[model samples]
Target: MIFVRLCLNTIVRRWNSTELTKVQMPAIMHLTRLGYTYAVKFHDNQAGEDYVPDTNILIKIFKEQFERLNPDKKDTFNQVLKDIKMELDNDDLGRSFYNRLVSVSPSRLIDFEHPNNNVFHCTAEFTCKRDEDEFRPDITLFVNGLPLTFIEVKKPNNNGGMLAESNRMNNQRFPNKKFRRFINITQLMIFSNNMEYDSEGGIIPIQGVFYCTGSKSKSSFNCFREENKGGEKVAPYNAEYSYKSIDSLVEKRVLTDFNC
Candidate 1:
């Protein structure tokens, strides 16, 4: 599978274009190329909750992976989802959730030992609502139906650009208590306007794409850089991966348009 961050570097090279073509759609397609399935938006309705982790998909995938990972404990399969849901819901700052995600302490939510044994999905326009407040991220990446990270793409050269999006997330989004669970569930948040980073020594991120873990802090936002074997800065590869009938899939599914 292609590394997601490395694929995200494609945005910088095409920053001057529209949001969908330049960053959002390409990001989704890249993930699909990297073995992530493109989950249709309507399926998000099956989430059946105002909040996230998409319980419908979560339970289904968990059941499958749990059986696969814990073959000897097949009879205990029914309890694992409940345990995971309880742990995820009660998590503080996603610390517990993160632990479960990377390790198998609470339960084997993911099969880190066998990469191909897991399910990877990328969905667009995932909605999360709590009370009167709501958040609809541009794209969300799911592993075994657990929403671990989400991406927000801004129009290139929009007013205030990536900086403005950053402020909105920090000042408006993060401050809302309703989204606390959303924040807890999402381990990473990425914002991009397709602009290149300021190598001219800007102390803070003023352009390009930036990311933060769980939640944001005053100076927590960071950008990605690729280095070669010799440790010299290099550009990201704008490569394509040909899956079976990918051209047909891309053409038929308007959502996966590869005009980029």
Candidate 2:
């Protein structure tokens, strides 16, 4: 009788410890600690409860980073916007993503149709192909004359491996669409989540998707190739990339490389 009781007690203790470990786990995995200096520097003191990033700030960052990268690409901005619209029109998911992406920018204040205006309006639910269902994306990014990039964001807490899932959705929605047209015009695709990074640099990959993160050090930016032939150090398709601080990206003018 005593032996049976001891066995039962051991089983109960192990189960209790497992429950405690789970209780202590964070609600969200892969939480990133924002650099304190960057937080302080970018702090907004405005009075409204609806604090958001100003469109001018985005424009400034793009101009500074993009121009520094591709000084020759200035005339193509309008064309880039058109390509974005074309892609979004072709896919329902793209349309939805575009709507959310715009909300984060201050340029949302500008009416989309004024000629020479710096902001463009987009439809969240629009019919593109004849006899096809209406489509939507999470957000659409537009400038005065062109659709720039389509941003798709997922909250990690709501979905496991949300970044990978979002990328899958992007492929399904925009497959066979000419990324080159947009890439030629805007320079890159930004696929980011609240916690991870997945991007396609302007170049085509012979292997996996090319990725980059915001970094203070230029040397820290590196690319990874995906392969079925595995090695111990090889990361799975959904593995997280260490992100460079957003502050470093802004300060370094990395986007300016596209403008050249």
Leading candidate by TM-score: 1
77-158 in candidate 2: lDDT tens per residue?
A: 4454334445544334344325633442322323344434333322111112222322232333344323343433343333
lDDT of 1 by residue, 27-76 (tens): 77777767788766643455544223423235565566777776777787
Model 1 clash pairs are: none
What C-alpha lDDT values do all the predictions have? Answer: 0.67, 0.33
When summed lDDT is taken over every stretch of 10 residues in candidate 2, the lowest stretch is 23-32
Q: Judge candidate 2 at residue 240 and give its lDDT.
A: 56
Model 1 worst lDDT window (10 residues):
48-57
Which residues of candidate 2, in runs, are more than 4 Å off? 1-134, 158-163, 166-171, 176-187, 196-260
Off by over 4 Å in 1: 1-17, 43-45, 49-57, 74-78, 89-91, 199-201, 216-219, 229-245, 254-260
